[model samples]
Target: MPHLEEHVSLRPYNTFGLAVQARYFARFTSAEVLRQLLALPEV
Candidate 1:
């Protein structure tokens, strides 16, 4: 499995207009699917 850094932040790259750190992250297209996926044990 792959892992990401916990506390790194970047200012100029994220379109969300905030510097953030993600131990785990993903993008979702549907609200229902996102909720279901988040409820999964593997997530």
Candidate 2:
């Protein structure tokens, strides 16, 4: 496996305006599942 470095950025524009490690991937079984996942705060 390849090394996964943090997804860093100088500007933090999230709700808190703070730096947070960006998520790389998300998996879903179907369209319904994807929609459910999309409703999540971290999606």
Error of 1 at 40 (Å): 2.6
RMSD of 2: 8.7
Residue 16 local lDDT, model 1: 79
- The ten-residue window of minimal lDDT in model 1 covers 1-10
lDDT, candidate 1, equals 0.58
TM-score of each: 0.39, 0.39
The sequence of per-residue lDDT tens digits that candidate 1 reaches over residues 1-43 is 2222344555555887697665555556777767866786656
Model 2 Cα lDDT, one tens digit per residue, 1-43: 2222345542455777766665544545678766766676644
Candidate 1 runs further than 4 Å off: 1-20
The predictions' CA RMSDs to the true structure, in order, are: 5.6, 8.7
User: Model 1 — TM-score against the truth?
Assistant: 0.39
Off by over 4 Å in 2: 1-24
